[model samples]
Target: MARQLDLVDFIVGLPMPVAASPQANPLDLLPRRPKAWERMVAHVPAEDVRISISTTWTRVVVEQLREDGCGDQLRANGSIVSHDVPPGLIWPEPCRLILMTATSAARIHKRWCLEEAPGTGLTNTFRFARQQHADRAAVSQQLRLLGEGQS
Candidate 1:
């Protein structure tokens, strides 16, 4: 039998680890950030177009872009980009919202593919999903509530 009084401890002990799925390398899934320049090019699709990118932090990718003379090209093309947009949002330009959305969707799909790349430890999403379900079930059993129905 289980008691409601044990809820605190059960809640505290949340996220029990399963033995089958060992901790994956943090580098195993190096999340790819969307290429702002390519996105702008595809969205605008012209011989010469100016685009402004706003971001919070100065990522290595951004630095590489500056080093690769993209800054000079953008300047010649009369485009200025800065990392100033709010979190979880594309560039704040109203005209580019739809294109940005499509680009964002594509970026997500690409990242998913990279995470599940062949020969990587993170390849088996099915196995990981099953392990997650099993872990959740074990936790639920350990924290079974008395006099309450479970879905």
Candidate 2:
């Protein structure tokens, strides 16, 4: 006993908010960017070298690099991550890349990155991956496809 429709709205009527994980002590979106930068240095070990960075959007690069990261110690203490790569792992480069994206290039420039720390050697794989509304676009596309299929 259900009615069927032939069209769907890609936009959800009520959108959920994009909030920081409270378990990680959620922060305002803007502040989270800088915090991510510091954590990138700490969480990723020195032995792991950079293979390729998607784009030059510094903050997004930093944010994605924190994929392997946990918690927000960096934000609270203002320190970079300091983890050690295991002995056997060959520092997964080439395959390991960070994808950073934002609405505009100009916005990405404001994240206030600490630049390349002089002593940290340029070998470290810390870079950005840019996307054009990739996340939202992907979700919308998926929803649309689902709707079309249902019809």
Pull out the clashing pairs in model 1.
Answer: 53-81, 54-82, 54-83, 54-84, 55-83, 55-84
Reference-based lDDT, residue 20, model 2: 61
The model with the greatest lDDT is 2
lDDT of 1 by residue, 43-100 (tens): 3321122111222222222211222123212222334354433432321222221111
Top candidate when judged by TM-score against the true structure:
2
Every model's TM-score: 0.15, 0.21
Q: Show the colliding residue pairs in model 2.
A: 42-80, 42-81, 42-82, 43-81, 50-125, 61-128, 100-129
Residue 109 CA displacement from its true place in model 2, Å: 16
Error of 2 at 71 (Å): 14
Question: Which lDDT tens digits does candidate 2 get at residues 30-117?
Answer: 2234535644444454223122222343342232232333322232334444444443343333112232232221232233211122
